[model samples]
Target: MSRWLLCLILVLGLTGCQSSAATNPKLPYAAWYLGFLAPNYMEVWLERADISDINGLIFPRAMGGVVAMGQPESLSATARGWPKRIGSGKGRSMTGLDLPYVVSLRWQSMVEPQTYHAAFLIPDWARRKMVESLPADCPVSGRTSDYRKDLTIGLAPGGVVKVWIMGPCLDPIEVLTLQAEIEPKGPYGGKSGGKYRPLSPVVKAYVDKYGVPYGSWWAPIPYTTVGP
Candidate 1:
């Protein structure tokens, strides 16, 4: 083959390898999205929260493994205002062959007692506690209400993982407290709610095991955006 042609082939081969590596980075855990959520949303929020840099640390929670020193490309895309398809906002669950993952949110208002809203998916023990601690018909709307905070935890073929949201806040201290409440706890200790079973298997297990429908463990980092 001509030298020029051979060089072109080599360059093309290297480019293909790089692209493949980007799509599958040999992550420590099997990462997938559940429900209507998408990684893109978290990417956007992370940038807005000023957590643009994770310091080259990638912790894969589900598989109980670490990814050494590598930053996520999604983080960069989010910083650059890349277009993404978040969801329809109509509320739907993800199904089929993809792995399972959870998303949690905690909204903390600047109000007194530092009212916090938390949500997550954990083993049965933690969920039961959350349910008992939080009011059944907890009001979700108010000027300083912790609404829109939710937890989605469940099993995917790989294992379990949690995603959490904490904030748009004026007080850093309050945000810290809200972040501390979502850590996982022991197994279920209370009665199960038959009426709530159909809501979400992952959530139900949490309630059945811990009396709380979600675990609490979230810490808010800063996020920022660069463009209009």
Candidate 2:
């Protein structure tokens, strides 16, 4: 059995092992990550069965590498430390804004740790709002996409944004699904405006108890910071 199958089996067994009364509420992003990783296993099995158009299978593993390593506590620690690393100039510049943003890191493959991609995504409306809200001294600037690597967006702080490190998958359905699940929700329970909130309590508890440990800083396409 392949590693993916083993993982699935393990998950299934754990689910079965628990009492029915022990059920826990699910996390939105956790489902998204599972969706992202499922296709890779499906593709692997299909390939072994001599199926065609197995390209879709590749993205799950690539994306799984990211989800596997994106532990919330670790990420929170990273966020807390970033202000210091960026130094007084950039750190103060970033902290002055009132918006919330996302940071994502993507690794090239499960094995290769030092290669990855990073990006920042801010909506145009958010940028305008930020400019209007903040003082003139802390104006935001956009970064151009080189295509080869690197993507940056500038905006006024305090709007919803998503930052992801994705593989070179021609089809991004899985990626889109995952994004939708994790994207912020508004105050009235819509899309997140601009902030990082913990996943639903059930989901948070699940991750705290069962999710894999995340500790990679050298992934290819690694380390993305998106915000106000």
> Estimated TM-score per prediction?
0.19, 0.17
- Model 1, 187-207: lDDT tens digits are 111122211112234333332
Per-residue lDDT of model 2, residues 114-204, tens digit only = 1222222224433233223222221233322111111111110111112221212111111111111121232212433432333445335
Q: lDDT at 35 for candidate 2?
A: 13
- C-alpha displacement of 49 in model 2, angstroms? 43
TM-score, cand. 2: 0.17
lDDT (0-100) at residue 76 of candidate 1?
34
Task: Report every candidate's CA lDDT.
Answer: 0.22, 0.22
Error of 2 at 227 (Å): 14
Model 1 stretches astray by more than 4 angstroms: 1-36, 41-121, 133-140, 143-149, 153-228
